[model samples]
Target: MKGYADRKDLPRFIAVFGCLLAAAILLGYVEMLIPIQIPIQGVKLGLANGAVLLMLYLFDAPSAWLLSILRILLSGFLFSSLMTILYSLAGGIFSLLVMTLLKKLRIFGIPGVSMAGAIAHNIGQLAVAALVLRSVESLLFYLPVLLVSGVVTGLVIGVIVRELLPKLTFLNNGGYQL
Candidate 1:
């Protein structure tokens, strides 16, 4: 069995995770700078989610989960309400779950997998918002918009990952740790 002590790249994992965390935080901040808004309560392009999905492919579920939670918390502290943190958590977990399932099926190529994650992320966030607000209205109205944004962002990020994959040797060897 492969042991952590035997791996020369153990420090590399910590470095990568740290970098991923930084990237997520940066993305969250940049997202706040963008002017796009859904007028409705819980819709977003979720560009930062792209990073999370990419990490999922490079790393393991636990790493992706950690990244998501860290990103949500940091973003909440920086730009949103405590309540927003809950929505972010719901969306991140749901999206991660969707991507994990799709990765297992190997149905859609890498881009497809990313798109799937984005859509699920949107759905999950909307669901949580609806529940918390005690109104199905947002879920009903937000689904189509979120779905559309999810597909578009997913494809964009998918293309990026495809271009990036061949170049990153670390990701190529399943170098990610849980």
Candidate 2:
């Protein structure tokens, strides 16, 4: 069986993880300032997830998990309170799990996998927030809008990754380094 840490891709993993972390922090700040409201609360473009989707297709699960954790940590330190860390971590893990499962099942290829990850990430975060706030009502109104937004935004990010993957030769199967 292939162990998580045993995965041969290292340099590529580091590169992707770093990129994801930077993107997450940048987007986290942007989201904080703009704070898009969908008339429901906690619904907005998690544009940083673009990097997460890219990593999911380029590397393995553990690598993706590492990237997510790094992003949450960095974003927490830079943008908001440590309490926000829980929501971010939960969303990241949930997103990674969904993407990994979809990839295992051979779903809609890399782009589709990325989309699935983004969508799940949003839903997971919203669900956690609803639970924490003790406002089940928010979930009822928010879920559908989130689903639509997730699909659209996820697709855009997925497409971007798909196009960029070809030029990112470092991520090629044999080129990944530690």
Give candidate 1's whole-model lDDT: 0.75
TM-score of each: 0.85, 0.80
- The sequence of per-residue lDDT tens digits that candidate 2 reaches over residues 1-178 is 1243466655555565676668767876786788545665556666777666656666656666777788888878777788788888888889889988997788477667777887788889888988888999887777888888878777877787778766765654644221
Find the candidate with the highest TM-score and give its number: 1
Candidate 2 Cα outliers beyond 4 Å, as residue runs: 1-16, 30-40, 171-178
Candidate 1: tens digits of C-alpha lDDT, residues 141-174: 7788788888887888877876776566464265
Q: For model 2, what is the alpha-carbon lDDT of residue 39?
A: 64
Cα deviation at 34, candidate 2, in Å, is 5.3
